[model samples]
Target: MKKPAKILTTAMIMLFSLVQMPLTQAAMITTGEAIQAQQRNIDRDNLLSMLQKDELRAQLAAYGVDAQAAAERISHMTDAEIAMLNDHLDEMPAGESFLSVIGLIVVVLVVTDLIGATDVFPFIRPVS
Candidate 1:
């Protein structure tokens, strides 16, 4: 009788251990899942930077947005705002054009000297 009771207790312990194994695995969160969750947080922060620009915030308010709610909605904004920001930058004047204007002035002066408008350059003697 004692030998049979000891065997039965040992079998029950083994079965319990087997049942707990699956539960432990189910409760475990994978490292990849944790990294993905962190990445999502970083993405949300980037979205907020775009949506929280002063000009963009004012534009949203003009469209009847609640300022506080606008901040909350940043995480949900689509790529449309990014597209609009890109378009806005495209519409700005190019800084290099100002330098081009100066070059044009120098070319005009050289052409005028060649045509005898003024004998400003000693190398170019006027027709006299």
Candidate 2:
């Protein structure tokens, strides 16, 4: 009983000695910057949700691209890529041409394939 108590006390002491407090950081952000950041997230969400459209999925299927894979690829896209896509989408008139959207998706997928993020395309060889 005494030995067990000694071991328990030693374990408690070691645990307390090894415990550490996490550090937190805070910074001031300008309103424009905050708005821009929020917009970026919204753009990314829009693009991801766009992949859920049945028409888009059929189009991707016609191109031999998997809808799920394309969605996964979009989720990994950078903020700049998302913004560029959003800008292109905004410029296009509604029901005018979905080709532009498909083109952009192909471009992003190809880029991701080349960078080793995905293997959707057969021709593009990922960098070693």
* 10 residues in a row with least lDDT, candidate 1: 97-106
Best by TM-score: 2
lDDT of 1 by residue, 1-128 (tens): 99999999999999999987754444677999798667666655654565556655565555444445544543443455334333444455776432332233234334545767643345765554
Which runs of model 2 end up more than 4 angstroms from their true locations?
A: 1-23
Top candidate (lDDT): 2
Q: What is the model-wide C-alpha lDDT for candidate 2?
A: 0.85
- Model 2: per-residue Cα lDDT at residue 64: 83
The residue pairs that clash in candidate 1, if any, are none
What lDDT, from 0 to 1, does candidate 1 have?
A: 0.52
Give per-residue lDDT, candidate 2, residue 126: 98
lDDT of each: 0.52, 0.85
Which consecutive 10 residues in model 2 have the weakest lDDT in total?
A: 16-25
